[model samples]
Target: MPQFAELRRRVIQGGEAHFITSLTRCVRWAQRGGKSNAYFAKTRDDRFIIKSLNKAEKASFLRFAPAYFEHMVKMLSGQRTCLAKLLGVFTVTFKPTAGGGLSAATGSSSGPNEGLDLLVMENSFYGRP
Candidate 1:
């Protein structure tokens, strides 16, 4: 499996994610809207999508993650047509490196900062764009 560091590097290198080792599928850019950016990834096993929250809006999401997940579960349960589901909620932290670049970290930092929060979701091919 590719570690978070590797994934971060790929993202930073301008490589739009084409695959996710954890999900084990080829990912493609599906759609993006609102304050957060979204993408759809498809595979024979199942279609998945990932939503990356904007850095500026992390605080709002962090505050309501639990409530949002609960509501989603209720609304999406037992829906066969729904190819995507909520897998997990995690925080992707980024820090400014000494070289003036950014590094993707897994937790919050204590020093002065420049980082982002990302919300990952499985893509549902309900209405492919």
Candidate 2:
């Protein structure tokens, strides 16, 4: 997570996100229907989306982080690309629910799961030219 954070900082400083905000202040809304019955939401500013990831997706993101970072560097240098900017990768721990099973939509579990894998990216609704 820290590595990704550092990469994000470098890329943003390199000017890949001149239009991007600090993401320090925003609102969140819960939505439904995503991979592995995960949860999804958009920030109030419409600049970013926070989504839950299943184990496979989490693994894939970590596996591809190096390539993704490289691609962002290339794009930053004016190579032209279409990849979504990955802002952050994180985990949200949830306490077990009374039922002892994870909720398919919210990723909250009734004492059965430890946390939700999360991915944060630039919202597709904004920043297109």
Best by lDDT: 2
What are the Cα lDDT values of the candidates? 0.49, 0.68
- Which 10 residues in a row give candidate 2 its minimum summed lDDT? 13-22
Worst 10 residues of 1 by lDDT: 10-19
Encode model 2's per-residue lDDT on 1-129: one tens digit a residue: 565566566654434354245344555555655335567667666777777888888898889988888887787788887777888877766665567754443653334557777788877657666
Off by over 4 Å in 1: 1-20, 23-46, 55-84, 106-110, 126-129
lDDT of 1 by residue, 8-92 (tens): 4433223324334535554556555644444334543444445555655566766765665555545545433342334443454
Each candidate structure's TM-score, on Cα atoms with residue i matched to residue i, is 0.43, 0.64
